[model samples]
Structures are given as C-alpha cells and as structure tokens.
Target chain A: MNKIFEVPLYAYERSSDQDAATAVRHKVIVIGAGPVGLATAIDLAQQGVEVVVLDDNDKVSFGSRAICFSQRTLDIADRLGAGSPMVDKGVQWNVGKVFFDNRQVYEFNLQPDTGYANPAFINLQQYYFENALVDRVRQLQAAGAPIEIRGRNKVEAIGTHDSHVVLEVETPEGPYNVEADWLIACDGANSPTRRMLGLDFDGRVFEDNFLIADVVMEADFPTERWFWFDPPFNRGQSALLHKQPDNVWRIDLQLGWDIDKEREKRPENVIPRLKAMLGEDVDFDLEWVSIYTFQCRRMERFRHGRVLFAGDSAHQVSPFGAMGANSGIQDADNLCWKLKLVLDGKAPEILLDSYSRERVQAADANIAKSSRSTDFITPKSQISRLLRDAVLDLSEHFEFARPLVNSGRLSTPCTYQDSSLSSADALNGPDITRPGSACPDAPLGDEFLLPKLAGKFTLLTIDAGAPERIEEGGVEATRLALSVKDDLTLELKRRYLGDATGAVYLIRPDQHVAARRDTFEENAFRQAIRRATGKE
Target chain B: MADLILTPNLDSADDFYAGLLAAHDGLDKSASDALNARLVLVLANHIGDADVLTQAVKAAALRGS
Candidate 1:
C-alpha cells in the first residue's frame, strides 16, 4: 500500500460549530470531501460564497481508482487552480491500440491535431487527484476564502425544509445538528444521504463482474491504452491495460457473472493470472486488488427543492469508458456557477433547475454510451456474442469492420444542445462552437482561449465590434476581443469562424457557448444574458 | 435513399441459392448460425446505405412474420 493513504491529511479536529448551543446555519453544506465535493466547494469559495464541506474520511482514497482524466476535465481543473499539479504528476497519452486474440487490430490517436493547451487524456491515480484538490482548498483557506473542510464529520440524517435543510451529523465527540440554506450531496454511489431521502436510481445493472488489479512493476510497455478481446491468456473475456504514474499499471480483467468474488481477488489466485499475461520471468508486486460490478443508472432528478445531488451520489456507470468520474467532475462544473447565482440573488432560484435538467441530460448520455459499450464487451446472448466476435474477426482484415469493434468508446465532454439557457445561434460558425457547446481551445499568441473565458460571462468577439462590458439584469459579461489577423496559427479562425468574417459569442461562466451571432447587437446580447441567467 | 430491390436483381437466383445452401451444408446448428450472422454482416456492409438497410430489415421481418 502507498504511504499517502496511511497518513491523514485532514485529521479530526473539533470545530466551533460542533459546540454551538443551537444548530449552526451555514450558507451551503457539501457532503463527502471527494473530488466532486472538493471541486464544488472550491468553485464556490473562489466566487466568494461561504461553503462548509464535511466528510467521513480524512485521507485520500485507498487505491489508484479512476486513473483516466479527460482533457475537458483538465480544462475545468485549470480554472479551479489545481490543473498544473495534476498535469505535472500525470502520465499523458493520446494513442490507444485494440487487440483481438493476440493480434493488434487497429490503433487510434485521440488527439490528432494539437493547438490546445492540454492533452487528450492523462492517467493519474485518484488519490493524487484528490490530494491536489485538497491542496487547492488549503491554498484558498490561506488566502482567506470562506471555505472549511471538517474531517470525521458524517451526516446521518437529513430533513428537507421549505427554505433550508437540517442534518444530524455524527462525529468523534457525539451527534450534533447543523443547518444549511442548501445541501449538496457528493457522497459516493452507496450514498447514505440519498437513501435517507428515499431516492433510488432507475436503470440497468449489468450482469458481469470485473477485477481491477493495480500492480507496481518496471516494464517496457509503451504509454498507451491497450485493450484485448478474448485473448489467449484471458480466453473468452476482455482485458484492459493502462499506464499510470509511479510505475503503477492498472489491469482490468473481465470475470463472468457467477463467480466467488473473494476467491478471485486473493493474491494466490491473482499472481498466476498476472504471470500468464506478463511472462513468468517478470516480477511484480500487487498493490491493490478489488472486484466491481457496474450499473448504468441515475436519480430521477438531481435537485429536490433545496437539496441537490452531485457526482456518484446521483449517477453511476461502468468503468469501461472512464465516464464515471469525468462526468462527475463535469457535474461540479455545471453546478457551482448556477448555485452561486442563486445564492447571491442575482438570478431566480429556478435557474438552478437548469442545472438538474442539463446534468440529467448529460447523465443519460453517459449511461447510454456506457450501456452500449458494456453490451459490446460482454455480450449477453449467443447471437450477440457471435455478432461481436464476427466484428472483431473481420476487423483484422477489413477497414470498415474496424469501427464496429468496440472496446470502449472512451469519454468526451457533453454539449447541452437543447439547454433552455442557450439563445438562438445565427452565426453559422463552426459546429464545435455553436450555442450550447463547450468552447474548444484555440491559440491566441501565448495564451489559450478557455483560460480567458474562465469563471465569468464573456463576450468573445472575433474581428467584430462590441462594448467593453455589457450588464443585463445584474449579470455582467465582459468583452474578450480578438482578430484573425493576430492569429498566426489560424486556429481561432478555423475553430470559431468557419466561413463568417466576424463572430460574437456569449460564453457562460462554465465555458459553454450561450449564444453566437455574425455581429454584435446591443439588444440581442442583452437579451441573451438575461435568458442565460434565467431572468427571461 | 433508394428503396430495397424487391424485383429480381440477382443475375442467377438459383445459383446464388445453391451456393448459400452449400456454404452451410455440413455445419451444425451453432456453426450454421454463426456463418449466417457473418454472411448477414457482410451483405449489410455491402449495402452500406442506412435507409436501404432499414427497408430490407423491415421487409425481412414482415416476411418472417
């Protein structure tokens, strides 16, 4: 085991709130100090919103879980001030190879073109990711941000009121009561908070089990994602190998439905399997071993009155596509800005409803893609297996069949195409930057485009005329003017202005395009800001 | 999108039928099923247009019923 997990980073320290005679009411209380919870708190605190985070544990997670982080996630982390450390400690890879029965079928490059600031994906241990986030929280605290993280403070009961939520928390001292104007539950999949509220997820539970083994070894395998289907070593099942930082390799092997999970996880049974895959001469030590059965499900709604759910507490999917944690981080990204507006009374409370609507749409998309991948990887019926194997076999010979072979589709950022907040798109710009799409990164001399749009409504003007700032219904959108003549790389023109000579884009604080037009008009831009902030 | 060819398009219909039957002559139930799946996939790829495939699938389902 790693030494990082042994030492408590945020040890149990008594807080003044625990000793207060009456239940202390906080502006916002976030449950579970995992990645999503920490991100929510950090985003809120950075915007000067007071938030309190409570967790049942004090240290990072025990194992290298959720090792694959997508570029969109890195972009969000960059805005939160934790991107540099994570990127520094992560293994970046863009190439992935698919193998069938000991022969490589085809390889893919995730990042074919590179003018962006981040790579397509980075492999970092979940513990390191969490530690980076917690470190960011500490930095914010030192800078006098109104955020507090309490360890060993677990909420056991929850009561939803008309205007606030009351929670009965259990700590080392005893049980005490706390109140919050709003509650955000980032507790994990088996969320006690969700259960206390009598909520459940509605979707399919796959009938296959997977064994995840993290081993420390020095090997010569290239830093790329390698997935095998029905290999000789693991006959009739699938296996995935990925490189992580610190010489830790993540290996996932598919185990059929009816097996003793405990026996399969034993080192005695695991070492032989490793020896078969990596020849008998290779020496390695098992760092962590676990078995997981996955489901593609989510809550009916993420927000219920004043209580909200984020991360694994609201949705879950199989680990095949790395969608679980990536989508959860996006949940934090979609939520914090709207929550900030609601708390500050700049926008109507119904604006938070769009968070649930949009994220639930995103969750459904993740679930659909994940479910299809699971079906392709683990065929349920004889006919389905025959078709799947046929695809794999033909892929080795035919170019068209290669696309039919499904290892895992991997994850991409979700675009809120039908979001109510998005105004009519009239720019005829690149589809990648249309209304409701996450703004793709482009080069602007030494800086990138996403960082310039960080955490505020900005009017991104390209060879167009716009005011320095536009205020609508108490929401402000500042201008970020650019010209194609200054873009030596032409990436901004290619990504933002496909055929139009000039473009103006209204970008939300979450870095999603709210509206775009060929040219700026004051009345239209002002109405777009109002629509995006839920004032309309 | 073109409609599925319901008319006689095969140059030698009997010959094609004979060849398909010969392909599955000695195979058992499972092997024959596997072979049929591969053949279907091959033909589907050959007729790559999605609209034509949907029409053919609907026609085949109606015939089966």
Candidate 2:
C-alpha cells in the first residue's frame, strides 16, 4: 500500500588525513546551516570574528518552508549584501484578497507610507534563501575572514567554561571537540542544543493538519494573493492558493477532522482534485506536497551561560503569517551586535542577559500573533466559525469594522514590557514609543528613516540640547533632527515636544530604543544608559 | 429594449471568471478601465492560483507599508 522512497543526501564530505579532533578555537560556533544560522555566521564573519558553522543536513532542502520575507528582513539582507540577488529571484507582492464562503470580504494593498527602502513583503523559497546565505558565507571565507562549514557534523554536546564553550561535534570520522567564545544554536524547532542544556520549549501544538502543495502550472494568474473560506475544494475543507515565479504556485488545503485517520494520500486523490478545480486541460505537475501540524511555543530562556539559542531554537510560530522565520531573523539582527560587543570586550558579560530578556519578549509576541493567525484560519468550533462569519459581514458594511476584520495589528513590532532594562514609567504603562521599543522608521531627506539608523545605535530626542546633556550623563548619544513622514507629509520634528527636552533616549545597536527620557536630566539619562548597556 | 435571458446551473468559479471576462468585453471596455478590471481579476486569479497564496497573505500583513 506504500512505496519506499530514499532521498539522496546532498551534504559535502571531505577526505582528511589530518587529526579531526584537534581542538580549534573559534570566536563563534554556529550550529545549523539554515537561513538564520547562516545569516548569523555571515554577520560574525563580516565583523572579523572567527566562525564555524555545522549542520547535519547534506544540502539545502527544497521546500516552501519560509517563502515570505518582510520589508525589515529585506533591509537586513541588503545590509549583508545579499538583498540584490535575492530580490532578483523573489517576487514582490503588496496586495491580498480574503474570501469567506465564496464571497470577498476583506482586501489589503500594502501602500507603505513609512517610506522603507524595501516594500512590504517579498516571496522566495527557503532553499534559495539558504543557498544565497551559504554563498555569502563562502565569499567571506575566501576573503580570509574564514568560516569553517562542516556539513555532515552534528553538534553532540556543548559545555560552557569561564572563557569558552567546549563543543563535542559528531562527524563521520567520530566525535571531535572544538572550542568557541560563544555557541549560537540556530539548529531549529527540535534543537538538540537546547535539549542538551535542558532548556524547555513551552507552548501548544495545534491538532489540525495542513496539506501544502507546490505545483507548476501554465495558467494566467494574478500577482495578488487570495484566501478562501469553506471552499468546496475538498468538500467542507478550506483551501488557499498563491502565485509564485517560474510558473510555480502554492496551494494549501485544510484536511478536515472527518478525513480518514490513516488515509493513504496517493497522487490519485490529489491530482483529480486539482483537475476538477482548474480543469483537466490545464498543464501542471505537483512539485512537492507535505502535511504539517502547527505549533506556538517559546523557550523559557534564550541564553544558558555562553551558549545562546536563536530562531526556532528560541521560538516556534505557526506558519500563518510566515512569522517564524522572519522573527528568527529579527532575533539574529538583535543579538548579533550585542554578541559582537561582548566578544570584543567593549561590553561586560551582563549585557548577554538583555538578549534573553528582549528576544524572549519578541518571541512571545510573534508566537501570539502567529497563533492568532492560525486560529483565524482554522476555526476550531462551529461557534467560532459563526462568530468569524458575522464579523466578516459586519466589516463589509461598516467603515469602523475594517480593522477588526483585517486584524492588521499583528504585524507591528511587539513592545517589550517584562524586560528588566526599561524604566519604571515604561514598564508601568502601555506606551507606543517607549524605552525598549523598536524605534519606528523616521523620514530622512528622501529615504525612509531606517536607512540612516543602520550599523549603529541612534538616539533621537526632542530637546535640541539633550545630546550634550546625555554626554554629561555619561551616555553616548547622537543628536538627529529626524523628520517622520505621516500620511504622505513629513512631520519635520519630534512627535512630542518640550517635556521630552533634555529627555535622553538611548538606542541599541539593533535600533531598538534602549532607554528614553521624558525630561532631560543628566543622572536619569546616565542611569538609563547604564541599564540599557548592562553597565548597571 | 433588452431581452431577459436566464441561464441556470452556473456554479464553477472558472466559469464565473470566464463569464465575468466576457461580460466586460461585451461592454467594449476602455483600456484604462480594462486594466483596472484586469488588475482586480488577475489578482483574484492569483489568490486562487494555489502555490503562492500563503506567502502573499504574509506579505500583505507586513507593517508600515
């Protein structure tokens, strides 16, 4: 009743007569050759840090694992010089349509007024993304900024000593011990690194199974996106379709609970359904089809001694918003600078704790958003479905009901509340632009505000004299006259005035507001700066 | 005077799209008007295309433009 299929391993193997166990010390040892791990490795290598990347997989697995990248991620990739080629291979999309029971209910076109260099989202398969990042890693290696990539080597154990983390990696030749200043585990959802350290990934796994199908078809399709509700694609099941480049498209069908528990999913059951939908005359072949159960979870802590966890190792989001990979990349972007500062001895070890605090906040927020998206997509009960349909109906008629229907709040960066770094005022209340918040993009000349904030931490204050006061407060601050574009008009001053004068704002390397001031006072600014940098 | 002709049993989505396209052409649609119509229609087709929809949804959800 089943056919045996053996997928060939595409990992690279080398014949080495040299001693394999010769302990080599690296500034950073990244475990995982996936996009996040590779992105981390490239950032470290670019900063002149010695690096090594190891993965169990032989080569990049072709799949629609993480096909959607955010504008923020595109900017990050641009900074690393991988954006151009990636953008070439990917499709830029900004429009979407949602159909509820064969009736169009909601629509959104990404008319980004925030003025970011990149558009709202770009689509590219996970495999091509990994290839691009791996290629970047190799380019860095060729430039003498060496990165040792061990494809077949799987990390077995990691022990952090006072100065270094000792890693026992299992290779074909046997187990080999290596040392690194820091060990980053981007290994993935079931991270062996996190398990080895006894870190618990606490969360919930959805009971539903989603069938993802990638097909190559010669049909004239729109460049926009559509999601159908309770469509008769599979009879009482929901289905989703999207257009991709290279004549390929992605399809997802909700396999309802009534499906045979042990149903044999032959090509016969799938192809006929496709033929029925698009007509049998349409030429197409199923490229890949897989079923995945979603999960929403985050680790108790992202850091254990010197070994750190990032990406899926830190948090797992449902595939609903493509939040998992995007959030993971954001984690890498946040942690890279702090790790660099600590490794270079520019900052103390206490700074590492902020990584856990801030990223865990982000991880939690992403999980919540993705979970909500998953819930919205797969209504668990009849009541839930009824409520959803009612809301959709309301949205169509009432102007005030659109936000409730669209649910666009999930896309905003999460404001950190539980982190120890924020001021009492920030932690005590809900404020949009507070300390520990991701400073929203400001307009600069013709470009959106973020391009100017690249590479270094920036502090934007309303009090023109606050930059000098911050210096006196023992904090490093760069005063900028930031013009934020609001509704096609550039507001050429700080959003708040007067009281924020001399109110010091400290920004982190990741451009998050590390600390902020409502009143320009030297001691308070100093204390906030110290807290942000972990000098306190 | 317009003749009222009713056709029954039209259910398929593809058939609907074809009927919609034909009706637009029957009106002798202008190029700019046709472009806007095609934009919406094509986008609808893409949404129903089956390969890229989920990514499109995520992309559509992006913050701040």
Candidate number achieving the greatest lDDT relative to the actual structure: 1
For candidate 1, what is the lDDT?
A: 0.89
Q: Give the per-residue Cα lDDT of candidate 2 at A295.
A: 61
Please list the Cα RMSD from the true structure of every candidate, rounded to 1 decimal place. 2.3, 12.9
Q: For residues A1-536, write the lDDT of model 2, one tens digit per residue.
A: 32111232335565241265478777888999888998888877777777888888667755666777876677777766677677788886668776666567777787755545566677877777777786777677788886767778877888879778988877777777888889999999889998888778886655456677788887676677766766555655566676665767787777754455335256877787677555668888898887765567788888888888999888887666677778788778777877877776666787888888888888777766665655556666655555555555555555444554423232455566556666555222125456666656544556555555555555655433454324422335566543223314433234322223234456665666666655456677667666666676
lDDT of 1 at A12: 88
Native-referenced Cα lDDT, model 2: 0.67
The lDDT per prediction is 0.89, 0.67
Error (Å) of candidate 2 at residue B1 is: 60
Interface RMSD after interface superposition, each candidate: 1.1, 13.6
DockQ, prediction 1: 0.55
